[model samples]
Target: MKNMVKRYGFNVEASLPKVPNHPVESKEWLYGRTIINAVRVVMKAQDVQISIFGAENIPATGGALLAINHTGYYDFILGGIPAFVRGKRLVRFMAKKEIFDTPVVGSLMRAMKHVSVNRAAGASSMEDARKHIEAGELVGIFPEATVSRSFEIKELKTGAVRIAESANAPLIPLIIWGGQRIITKDIDRDLGRSHIPVFISVGEPVDTSGDPEVATQRLFEAMRTLLDETRHSYESQYGPFDGGEPWRPVSLGGGAPTLERAKLLEIAEKERRQAKRDAKKAAQAGGRRNPVTALIARLKKLIKK
Candidate 1:
């Protein structure tokens, strides 16, 4: 491992390019730029050495739907690096509504013009993404809908193909490996100078002109292939998985859960969230049925009459 690290690891200072002074039309607003600059500083401080491959596949001009695989919370940030490197393109990611409801982070997400998706009312968010793409903006979406605890490609939602077909944009498959080492599900985070080697790969735009189901399947296969290649390269350079590394996937003989187990965990999580929502709604209903509240309502109606 030491010899491989010495031979293959990169120096952060040498890997990153000089920050570009993006033009106003980039649509990276003042707050967005500030957040991105801060993120750059944080990434540098953490000594993250990112290697982006096939960045040229990201079109220099026009709308593109980046369908990225999700493994960790930082996937969104790391996944955007390729587009930025390609042509200073800022991707408007479609994230969950819970993140948008967050206090400071939510404000920043809005300021960055990210689209918020409500799982129950997702059409609005899809429409928002379509508009962004139609206007020649790059849009990013995690087709898996949530982080894959297995560190492998999960079954994808059809939103990626649907949005691309509707907006007449190219759907690009992208994958990021090694960000899971910094932060991921069921693991403690190490935000220090870990010098983690992060890998990002972009594949050619997928053909979304066909049936949505078929296009989604093709997109999934493309991402899975890209992920397999990236993971193999990462293990070759920085790993000889001893079958104990929590960050490595089970398929690679590491400690992460298998896809079947991860699916069960996701279902459990969804049920837990549903229970919480049900409790909250019941409490609200009980409040509305309070005798004092009912009396006030009746009095107001009588007065109006």
Candidate 2:
């Protein structure tokens, strides 16, 4: 704890204060959350209900790797209160770039310091998350790479492990149930989806034990346990969850170590392509291309197509 104070600006001598200048509470983002909360309240007035449990385990200090099971965008709302109750402030979340890119919400996401990841790059959002944990800030991550189909849990991603291991952050697995009914892409549905009852539980922090692999494995188990408990707890009230056992964690770093050879080749090819791109940009800016740059381009382009 003392080391955390010196290494990360945490005041271990006292209870951790909510991170001031937290990207999530930036004025723009807070207002946006306010709107969401207001909407939730209105929905609650209409009978939308959400129940949260194990709210105490979340700590007020130190870096935490918040691993969550993905259900939907609104899961943030369903699951947020647990952390808010503990963080005493909002924590940053890594959301798709497009959601934050919208005119109004984009401004909010930016202020909140939510990460914008381009999935096409094949990098899970963990790289973005590691940057936050390294700074001793709190981050929320979903283990499921995408939305759950039918509110049934899905395989977990290695990204959560990567963030915790790479940044050496403590991992916190969050169990979410019944958030699958909030909002929708279907325009025909009323935008004001109200008072959907949700059940949330915050599990114990993963024990890292200074072993990256061990820590990540424990975190993976922790998530599975949380989800299982959530299913059992809510099944009677919310109905049975129609999902299988969650996918194993991909890597201690949130990606498998044994990458496919083709993927590696693709990466190499991408690097060559990028090198050529950089060379071209440089050449264009420099006027005539360099002989070396010209040569490099030929090798990179390999016109197989």
Which candidate number has the best TM-score? 1
Global lDDT of model 2: 0.59
Off by over 4 Å in 1: 1-27, 287-289, 292-305
lDDT of each: 0.83, 0.59
Q: Looking at model 2, which ten-residue stretch has the lowest summed lDDT?
A: 1-10
lDDT of 1: 0.83
Worst 10 residues of 1 by lDDT: 1-10
Clash list (residue pairs), candidate 2: 23-112, 48-195, 48-196, 49-197, 100-106, 155-247, 158-254, 159-254, 162-253, 162-254
lDDT of 2 by residue, 1-305 (tens): 11212102111222333343334443343533565467546645656555656655666656777778775566665555565545344557777766876998888677667777667753656677788778766788776666544343455665677677778777788887655555522112333545455667777877756555565667767877787676666556654444432211122111212234324544676699899999999888887777999888888888743
What TM-score does candidate 2 reach? 0.60
TM-score of each: 0.86, 0.60
Task: Give model 2's clash tally.
Answer: 10
